[model samples]
Target: MASQNDHFASIDIGSHTIRLLVARSNEKLEIYPLRLERRITRLARNFQEGQTLKTPGIRESLRVLEEYAGILKCHGVSDVACGATGVVRKAGNGEEFLAEVRQKTGIAAEILSETSEALLSAKGVLSVIPRTEGYILSFDLGGSSTEFLLLDTRREKPLWHTSVFIGAATITERFLSEDPPPLEAVSRAVEAIQDALAPVFQAIGSILPAPPTPFPLQVVGTAGTATTLAAMNLKMTDYCPSRINGLPLTENWLTATIEHLVRSTLALRREIPGLEAGREDIIPAGALIVREILRGLKQTHLIVSDAGLLEGLLLDLIEKKYGRPQALVSPLTWRMQKG
Candidate 1:
């Protein structure tokens, strides 16, 4: 069992941003994230012709890692796990970049396989949603990739999983060349998404069993893209997970929201509730991605989950090293650590 004061950490180095989560698992079987931080590094922006981390990207990432290392040391983190996503995995020079990162930070980062990443994201999002019996599909849209997972509640197992290389950031860069993208360009982007998702849809159709009638299939949305959309739908002035998570979003509302987002300018988007400053540039692309996902799944409704990979990593660490405890830990303990 982990001691009351023992600290653990997980870092997710993504294409658009790097996130670090530090948590403490107490003797009472409680795990709380003590500190969380994210920095936008745009690592994938330079991965144009090939999978290579640009010189500026490398320098930025190294600086962030140096700072994060200091923070971990200050907090006395004992067990640490770091992982890289699309940019690193797809880059031709990924191995060399990762080697340098390890040498500099003393943290050997694991590049999570697409399936593994999908599963971890599903596990994390599921943890936050309302427990129910039926099939659930989880979607996580990122900067350089999008992951899909089907979870069978009846069997308590994942049924299917896949990662698509198309994401809001990447798609925006590819299609939104015009200040306000032309209608033709937008249509082309949609067509491209449909083409890319054909295989994923086929895979889902093949593996997912027919659901029992009367119980609608649940679709869960997580990550920055989903959360931001949920926030916009709810008309929040600022992002608040407590207000957004598990909130029901109907298909009609989703469609209307996407249309509204597509028609709005960046300046107008910034005025909308719950849209932060940094997200204005990518919100349109993100909204389009969400709209396509709903269309692909034939989903009529969605449930938003604010939690994802970070929480999943925490749970896995607890279960793997510390045996399951008999008593339940207070949710407040976990809540307090979000700072």
Candidate 2:
């Protein structure tokens, strides 16, 4: 309806990390990223259902958002879109925390509902993994919750989607406590993850149509857990987004890593090539969550998508500004074209 050519920013404040994506739009409706960054604050650290946002987490996230605000100022970006998930949505002090953010940084954050998180994340995941099968199952594994979205490529909307209470940090806190966790701890964690997923799988089965005239469902994973695992698989010393997209994470690798992570101490896990520093405590639990979800769906491998709600936030703003394009340029393709 109107011309839109301005820099925009999107922040996804999650249970475990705070992510920023700054981009500019063009006449062709393509997105060009000016910067991409993520910092682990564990906003839901030591969090449980119906809890308050922790003091330490609030402090750290505010610090990071201040830095993000500085970055936005450098880019001359005034229009910002933010979506807070998992911790923010479930916390009793969600609005208060947001108010503090607004007061300090002059940025307002919308606490995204679980379903909206799933849908936006799926769009971002779909944007990266080009030409996937008709039946796509995408999951974003975060600190306090995991969202599962089943999408059919031919359809405009998802077939089924839901968010569950279990996530990397929570599952580890509940079931895996030992550094270099014992076999018992690993076993118990696996059992609990399976139990939590059982009903979700059953509902999926009830609704799922036979896949793609013959093709099986395409599984894709997002958020910190998935991207970190993808990095580990590639033995990547530094994080890379475009390369991480559509990378296959196999069951054998998943199970082997699970075993290795369980046997290694937190300090030892940090030594591993791809594992980031702050994630050592929750990785074992995160791997198991990935394992159990795959096990339930009878899927062997999942595509790792570095892009998710973070990118989705930017795409959404572009649409709102210029209205939906005659054709959309997904974030991944835009990056490729910019190259």
In order of appearance, the predictions have TM-scores of: 0.90, 0.95
Candidate 2 per-residue lDDT, tens place, 19-138, comes to 998887776766778888889998988888988988999999999999999999998875788999998899999999999999999998999998889988987887777875568888
Worst 10 residues of 1 by lDDT: 325-334
> Among these predicted structures, which one has the highest TM-score?
2
- Quote the lDDT for 141 in model 2: 95
What's the distance in Å from true for residue 110, model 2?
0.8
| Reference-based TM-score, model 2 | 0.95
Question: In candidate 1, which residue pairs get closer than 3 Å at backbone N, Cα or C atoms, i.e. clash?
Answer: 33-337, 51-91, 51-92, 236-274
- lDDT, candidate 1, 211-330, per-residue tens: 646545788888777888888778888666677779877778867776676677777878888876677767777777777777887877788898777666666666555765311111
Worst 10 residues of 2 by lDDT: 325-334
